[model samples]
Target: MTDEPNEIDGDLYEHHHIVVDAGQDLLRIDKFLMDRLPNVTRNKVQAGIKDGFVKVNGAEVKPNYKVHPMDEISVMLPEPPRDEELVPEDIPLDIVLEDDHLLIVNKPAGMVVHPAYQNWSGTLVNALAFHFQNLPEMKGNDGRPGLVHRIDKDTSGLLVIAKTERAMNGLAKQFFDHSIERTYYALVWGVPEEPSGTVYVNVGRSLKDRRVTMAFPDGDFGKHAVTHFELIEDLRYVSLLKCNLETGRTHQIRAHMRWIGHPLFNDTTYGGSEIVKGTVFTKYKQFVQNCFKMMPRQALHAKTLGFIHPVTKKKIFADSELPEDFSSVLEKWRHYIDHTD
Candidate 1:
């Protein structure tokens, strides 16, 4: 007996309602709304559940709440406020290789891979959406298209994207099976005692800071992470190490390097000392100061990526050159070496 309009005009001052029936029996709250409202997205549905806008039987419900044979489900969808929609930007891309099945691009730093809350435009997805005619849909609840894996927003590297559904499924399986060989180059603070070693640690959610992950000796919910590193070049004070990821975890390279006492330079989250000290301080004192001032993010980059092509079955290898900022740091360090020696 509600007089709510089926649809409202304007972007704001709008509301709607959806009734439940036996057909929706046992459907999760979020899934039910997605089916009922074609315009509403899964993320929007989840946000409504989090904001307590979704109620069942006159009670606020969780996202996983199952519907009965006969239930009253009320969903209040707030109109998006006035804002410019996603405008496709014709940004230049560094495409390494391309085929009908997949495309490999060298992602640059300072570019977001995909859009999320607050960041709706100017992402890699936006660029791809503009460039490509058809992009494969992502698996699971995340609605991003063609993105099988991800790198940090500030960390630049190589990324592989699928162009078709078959390619997406095959590539996603490669990531989960740890078949994708990814090698990263990092300029850490100090040299490790061993030239090459493996770090095996359990990475879990950080209890102190929810935003970061922490290593745990024994924890309830933790995943096994392994990183193998070899010292590629020793620049007197700083060591340039090449890391191969055995198991990909969130911030695995950054966290493991910090745990071993040689954090990457300018890594704020992993306790990289803003000021250089000890051997590094005395060796490249002036150069260290200049680096700390100029470099905004950690010195980490996915230098190499290798895998078997999902469709072609041919081995594919792609590499990215060191960014200008990282190369400049090495140049200063080389100058200090010459002066000190």
Candidate 2:
């Protein structure tokens, strides 16, 4: 029971409960939620209010409802409206592990995890639709079949998909509890001041620029996010980092690293596309441009994922080798660093 909202923790939202303070002033429920739930727009709260996902003392409330002291409030964020049915595609999936209850897919970069606006086709969900016959049996959060969690379209990684309802609930609880082990490899533009450290910060959507995420160092806004980072290699202008997520906030790694002035290399959204380091020589600029072309995306990959098997009650751990694009660019950086002064 709390008012804290994880604004961008993957696509899963938590059910929240709260009790009004003893001496609270009367305030609009929507505004109150907006203040408590950082990075959420007023309209979104109002929408949830309209959808009857928000209740006070077990009764649905209107957007204009005022809060009173001792009132018990509960809220559940609803999924966005789906305009079309998911269509299965013949896209090949690199399944790493599979059992009766669950399967782990090594998702490649550039593949959307589920159907959404502008990416309504050729998603991992679409492939799941094609591969499974018992579609009705695999429903998960937001009707995304078998999906317990997701990574970004450009962030390649391991994903565990539940094949049964029991599996789904079990895995979802692990994610909610933050017990699932997840680690990523990222090439950032600069080295951190520490070889290993944790970025304990709040990440939420920017108030001024809504398209990207911003860090709240003072915890003044957004959801709590923690990314543990260790410098795996220092390549002069760029560095290879191993990032372990303690809390899976939306853009946690990208935003947190950038906050400390080391955004993921070639991450255009986080201002990593430009050369943040290196000399202002024409040759250096050209070399970086070539590396960007070689990778053609952010230098981030989900390298390892581990969790307890939902039904088997056994531990599951999966690791993946770096993709060609990611490894090749690393080679380029390594060579360049060895050759340069």
Which prediction has the highest lDDT against the true structure? 2
10 residues in a row with least lDDT, candidate 2: 134-143
Top-scoring candidate (TM-score): 2
In candidate 2, position 145 carries an lDDT of 85
Residue 118 of model 1 has an lDDT of 60
Q: Model 1: how large is the Cα RMSD against the reference?
A: 6.7
Model 2 compared with the native: what TM-score? Answer: 0.77
Which ten-residue region of model 1 has the weakest summed lDDT? 5-14
Candidate 1 is scored at a TM of 0.76
Where model 1 places Cα greater than 4 Å from the true spot, the runs are 1-57, 60-87, 276-286
How does candidate 2 score on lDDT?
A: 0.86
Reference-based lDDT, each prediction: 0.77, 0.86
Runs with alpha carbons beyond 4 Å of true place in candidate 2? 1-83, 135-140
What shift in Å separates residue 305 of candidate 1 from its native position after superposition?
A: 0.8
Work out the TM-score per prediction. Answer: 0.76, 0.77
